[model samples]
Target: MTPVFQPGQTVVRREIMRGEPWIAMPQVCVQDDGDLLVTYTPGGTPMVYPETGAFPVGEHPWKLAGSTSWRGHGRLELHWTGVEHSIFLFWDGPQRAFQGWYFNLEDAPRRTPIGFDTLDHELDVWWAADAETYEFKDVVEFEETGPARYPGRMEQIRAEGDRIARLLDAGELWWDKAWADWAPDPSWQARTMPDGWATVPFEAR
Candidate 1:
């Protein structure tokens, strides 16, 4: 299949928070087999945090606090080789560099006019900075939310999570060591979303 996102293209990555959109610009890199690799630094924008019961009585769910800047760089590899799980690597700021990797087990992204879109499965794995140790995260939340939200696909999602966990435990997964040494091209300008970015709606899964 032909890749939907091209190398050097600027794409808006829209992450939904409490039903609202949080956006970021990530530079795209298309792989030889049509997978997509996106990289971005998470600073310069106010980070949003969900605050429970922080808003007025009528605005409970949407209440949020935007303050701290995310001090890190992130690389996400979106695979096209079936099963659609993506691996994320994060390098923290100057203080605590090389935080580690996160495996996001999710649905295959659907190509949209603005960009590609996928729903996160909640279940994930975290490989520590040491690179050998790892842990399963959000299993309770995944079990709680999967049935009610995803219905029939809960079992499949769990299986996918297990598969990734095994690969991580056995040290069979592929990760680029060079990414830890990567820096953005100095000549590339900072990216901003296109005019209609906010207008593109993600279909409810």
Candidate 2:
């Protein structure tokens, strides 16, 4: 069955299974009658993208609340593109570590590689907004286990997260344009170009 999407409505959509293509979990979902009213007004309701597939930006600004690190309170922005992208800065209360989650459009999110003691560590967890699975990455050296497998099962998941973060930071998905200015040296222009060809006159020499 085709999924219906309304501009001002909230719905719960999830894939049938993990790693498999996300399918809309076809359970009856009701709009929060109260939420719809306020959402249309000045303050809008938070929308959840069909977790079955990649979600567009603006789906949820409240997801980082579930993070376990530093009480895990933060916000992630899924830019204009429908990719898992966000910039998160949080405090680790127990460890007293300052951390940041920088998501590049192409690379997995990368933890702050600087500004911390070598003994300090960072663990990043991403709940697939679609699949009911959790992925994690940790930035620390290992002793018993090689750096390749300290987090064990969570290793692959963390690598993927880091890769995606790199892509987002590089602006691979959406490139913003900037302007540059070039001014020619008055004296240099006169010597380089033919006398009549140069538009600006020499101020020196």
Candidate 2 runs further than 4 Å off: 13-153, 174-205
Give the TM-scores of the predictions, in the order they appear.
0.70, 0.24
Q: Write the per-residue lDDT of candidate 2 for residues 22-110, one digit (tens) a residue.
A: 11111111212221111010111122222333322222223334321111322212222223333332334455343433332121211
Q: What is the lDDT of residue 167 in candidate 1?
A: 76
Q: How accurate is candidate 1 locally (lDDT)?
A: 0.57
Candidate 1 C-alpha lDDT tens digits along 138-162: 9998887667556788889988878
User: Residue 166 lDDT in model 1?
Assistant: 80
TM-score of 2: 0.24
Which portions of model 1 miss their true places by more than 4 Å?
1-3, 15-33, 45-71, 74-81, 187-190, 198-205
Best by lDDT: 1
Structural RMSD, model 1: 5.3
RMSD of each: 5.3, 24.8
